[model samples]
Target chain A: MSMLQVSGASKRFGGVIANEKISLEVPEGKIIGLIGPNGSGKTTLFNSIVGYHPLDDGSIRFEGQEISHLRVPEIARLGMLRTFQQTRIYGKMTCVQNMQISKPNRNEGLMSMFDRFPKEDLARIDHLLEFVGLYSKRNLLAGDLSFGQQKLPEFAMALMNEPKLLLLDEPTAGINPTLINGLIDRLKRANEEMGITLLVIEHNMRVIMNLAEHIYCLAHGEMLAEGKPEEIQNDQRVIDAYLGAH
Target chain B: MRNTILLVLGTIIAFAVPFMFPAYQNQFAMLWLMILFALTWDLMGGQMGYNSFGNVVFFGVGMYITAVIQRDLYFDIEEYAHVAGRIDALTPDQYLTGIFLGMGVSGIVTVLVAIILGAGILGLRGHYFAICTLGLTIAAGEIASGIDYIGAGSGIVTPVFPTELMAKGMFFYFVFMVLAVGTFLTNKWMLAGRFGLAVNAIRDDEDKAEAMGIRTKRYKTMAWATSAFFLSMAGGAAGNLFGFIDPINVAFAGATFGVWMVLMAILGGKGTIWGPVIGAAIFHITQELFWTYLFGWQRVALGAMIVGIVVFFPQGIMGFLRQHWPHLFGHKVDEQTTVEQGATKESEA
Candidate 1:
């Protein structure tokens, strides 16, 4: 069975229909790509899946449980999490501190919050920070980092949660070319070695084609196509709508 | 080791102040009360980034709760109203019991009010939240003034403290001191743990914090409730200390205590643990001095101070210190990277 299944998902922002009856599936342990033109409901679908907002119509089943009605933190606790196109880190906090708080222990009570964090988790946090090439910068305030470098800690932060499926929106958007391959390698290792599934939204064709096992294309709030990498690359509809434009 | 030394030194000074200057015992107590106010205010305003203008509601509510409980426990309302300070003083045991019970009940009731109020008002963000809280404070003051049971516009006098126990000023000075220290230590402990990280996360970017599974709403509510708990207790003690509980001027006192709490936090550098403590001490001492020396123009001097704080020291004294001397706060600064970054920034600009 699929790890995530979204059926008949629709979201409307008043006069604008952000997403319309979008259906998709991501089986466990697979890397899925979502590619679309801007405002084509790629993000809206991700938002709906991760429960950022309630869906007007649809069912999102994550690990065989309906999750559409849940709130963001609740959905996150259920082993699914997402990152944003524009990176968001706790600016006032050190990168290490940011990673420390992002652990998936949302159900811990107020009393437990007062308890000392396990020493083992600190080791894991450092390991993940090193994985993202941020070991040296871990002690620095996240706001002081350049815009492109901020994405690395955010990725590491999501990894700290150990989510069953990770959704990344434009992870490579702000990052420089030299770091993109390293990020891709980390994302792949997170999928294969750590056993976390990935559903990515990427505008960069090279990165998507290299990373995603299967690709879904969206256009004007509708699912335009879904195929393997070469098939998606060759699809006429994808070319005319998105790829050709680029 | 250094922190421990400072803590011990601070405690000794706190205990010695009332005996050293007997005449300024009331002023010293007010100092502690001001510290309590700033600390509680910062829990929401500085830590959680919820700038509530209505925390004074809890303060006023606590004052009324404590005074009413104290009055209702040992005295008849009709007789007490007529001769509040003049007749039927409680024994030392009764006085102690009444005040402690009043404070306990007020703290609990105020926390419940905060949870209920926070559920509604915390959903509003930014300036809307601020305005809503301001409205809540004004509305609470009006409601308190209209309630005849708690002494409407004229206000009610608290039961007089029996001289048999100790000097009123000295007794309450220690009380407020304990209250303030307890608040400070409690804040320090929580901020050292996951609670601190969670609230700071909420302050930085609430949406992302929520998405990261920090339970932003619950944390926000908890912070507000904690603030309410302490402020309410302060109110209870403050009412007895002042010997009266007037809704607007004394209990609620939005324009004075309410505004001062926020100012103190900002002036101390809101988000830091020691910021509120320093801000409260400096602001309170300065205000007292202005009251003495400036006489009728104390308000003008205060206005100038507030303006100066905002214009020259927007980040507060602590923030200014941190920027110039990061090592003081144990923040490691890479001199090489900083200079390189500065050069790049200048070149870019």
Candidate 2:
């Protein structure tokens, strides 16, 4: 069964229709790729699905419950999480601190947070830092990290609440090719090893083709095609859309 | 090691200075009060990044309430000083109530005022918030002047204490200790809590903090309230120390006090836990020395000092010291590391 279902979801901003009745299903435990050209509403769809924006018309069901009107943090608590197009790690914080902010119990009210979880959490932080390959630079401010290295902490942060479904928005936008490959491998390992579902929005066709089990193409805020990676590559509509044909 | 020893020595000197230099006791007490006031201002202004300019409102309120209770109400205590007469005249509860009433009334009034002002102005970002608060101080002064019962503009002179000088000295010391300790603990508590994290997050990026599940508005409101509580308490203590109250004393001087506190915090280190205390000490000392020695051009000299500090020590004294003496001042102080560590642990799990 689908873990997340978006039906007839539409969002418009001052005459600009960012998403036009975009409907999609994200199955549990599957890696799905969302592909679109610039301004094709991939990020908008992601935002709406994750409750960052209210739907102009229609509904979103996460874990079989309507969550269209829920606040972003409420949705996050319900085990749905999204990463940003731009890395949003705390610049002055250490690599491990970025992840700790995402801990479910950290927000368990102020009194309890103080009473419990200072020393134990600190130790857990060290372990997580090493896990993310940032143990050596754990003491360094996150802003000082290279662009590619920053994404690792960002990814780690998204997983803070141990979400079942994770959304990545252009995860490899400005990073080097080597880091891109490394990120894909890490993401794949995370999915296989931890049973986490992944939905990625990417313009990089090669990375999506390698990482996603299924691909959906969007143009002009509407779905153009959906199929397996090879099938998507060979689709006439996708080629025409890429080639600027109507 | 050297820093620890220096701090210890500083504490010893602070304790002994009043006793060794009898002529400077009043000066020392005044400076200590200023330091406490500045520290309170910095917690809300610098550490929380909310730049308040109406702290004097609470200081004035505290002073007035304390003055009214100690002089007007408690003067009856001396009138019935004969043990049997006093016992027959006033109930124990009545005396206790009067004491608490002074503190409670002052605290509540200040908090209410702060709330009204904070609700209206805390939504403003950056310098606008500061400016609005500053304007409120002037408005408050005018309003206080109109209140006849509270002695309007001419001011209310407090009755002299019947107690010995030693007792007054001890009272000042106790008050100073409470304010200093309160300021220090509150600063530490904030920096070590989720509220602190939220404030830092808000300071770094408001939109991001909201997106990250932080209720930015709620946190900001709480910060304002916390600031109001301490500020009012400090003001009440000051009122008792001075034994007087009036519109100008509470409101006009409050505005200046607010600015001075902000300056001290910025001069020491805006957000650091101990920065405000350090800034307050340095600022009060400099101001006292300059004002006492310079006579006529003291204001000009003080203004120049403020400008010089701002320009030369943008990050304040703590930041300057850290840069110049990393070995002495350095510690694991970055906020980002804790955030990253939290994030990484979740991914691994």
Index of the highest-TM-score prediction: 1
The pairs that clash in candidate 1 are none
Per-residue lDDT, model 1, residue A131, is 81
Clashes of 1: 0
Cα deviation in Å at residue B59, candidate 2?
3.2
Chain A (alone) TM-scores for all candidate structures: 0.96, 0.93
What local lDDT does model 2 show for residue B149?
A: 65
How high is the CA lDDT of each candidate model? 0.89, 0.73
Tens-digit lDDT track of model 2 for A1-246: 699998998899999988888888889999999997788899999888878879999899999999999977777767788888988877755565565665653255644323323777666666656556666666666777887788877777666557789999999989889878888988897788878899999988999999999898988888889999999999999988887787
lDDT of 1 by residue, A1-246 (tens): 999999999999998999989999999999999998888999888988888788999899998999998988898988899999999999988888999898887568867666657888787887787788776676788888899999999999999998999999999997789899999999999999999999999999999999999999999999999999999999999988864463
Looking at every candidate separately, what fraction of the true A–B Cα contacts under 8 Å does it contain? Answer: 0.54, 0.13
Which segments of candidate 2 are over 4 A away from where they belong? A105-107, A113-117, A240-246, B1-14, B64-101, B108-139, B142-160, B165-170, B193-195, B215-219, B246-249, B252-255, B323-349
Show what share of the native A-B interface contacts model 2 retains: 0.13
